[model samples]
Target: MATAPLKRWVKPEIYPLFLAVGTAVGLCGFAMARNLAANPDVRINKEDRAAGVLENYDEGKRYHDHAVRRYVSDAKPEIMPGINKYFSSSK
Candidate 1:
């Protein structure tokens, strides 16, 4: 004989309400995160930060770094041989 489950599942009407509430909570959380990201007082960048006990901090520098750009630009070009190379190079 088949046995009954330990617990009963939620009703269909209740499940939809739970789903909508969960989605609203998730959206609210995402909105808070986005707002926090835009706030300058909550700056969380570790890289390119001024090192000192009470040094002046600049958050704008984190957006663009010359060193990182230079490193990426220094990469050597790929050497693709044969007819494929000729067609690609023509573009």
Candidate 2:
């Protein structure tokens, strides 16, 4: 049996369109996943708030403060020296 010649695959000149569409779909999926993971009802109980259970409680503020302190402590060495130098040079 005689075999016919195989056609070469034609690459699209508008290949960037496909790449942009794929990137948009991936970003949308990532945003949806983030929204699902950060469901506020699960993180902060609305029922507890309605029942006055959290009226006297400061929810997560202490943790936030601690996190801020940690961040400031870690960042000071890198940030403050730059600021001081900038100010002194500007004087």
Candidate 3:
């Protein structure tokens, strides 16, 4: 018995129409999201603000320095041998 050709969910001729529609929808959604982000009235929560500040401004330098010092002094030298090298200095 010969095998029959598989049917497509969307016809080849109409697939471009679907592609165009999907592209337009995606672009519209992206524009809307961008506008929302740009809006000044958007209120970010305190935790998010704190995290963002810490991440963007390197406010955790003190804690990180303390942690690195503590790790170097207190942690076993054999474990994580070269890991300290990465956090040894900050540019």
lDDT of 3 by residue, 1-91 (tens): 2333434445588789999999999999976885556433333666655554233334344434555487678667666668776778686
Q: Which pairs clash in model 1?
A: none
Tens-digit per-residue lDDT, 1-91, candidate 2: 1333222332475578879989999999976775555433333456644764333334344433555487776564654787788877955
Candidate 3 regions exceeding 4 Å error are: 1-9, 41-91
Query: Candidate 2: global Cα-lDDT?
Result: 0.58
Clashing pairs for model 3 are none
Candidate that beats the other on TM-score, 1 or 2, i.e. the better one: 2
Q: Ranking by lDDT, best first?
A: 3, 1, 2
Model 1 root mean square deviation, Cα atoms: 11.8
TM-scores, all models, native as reference: 0.34, 0.35, 0.35
Candidate 2: segments with Cα more than 4 A from true spot: 1-10, 41-91
- Candidate 1 lDDT by residue in tens digits, 3-36: 3342244556678899999999999997688556
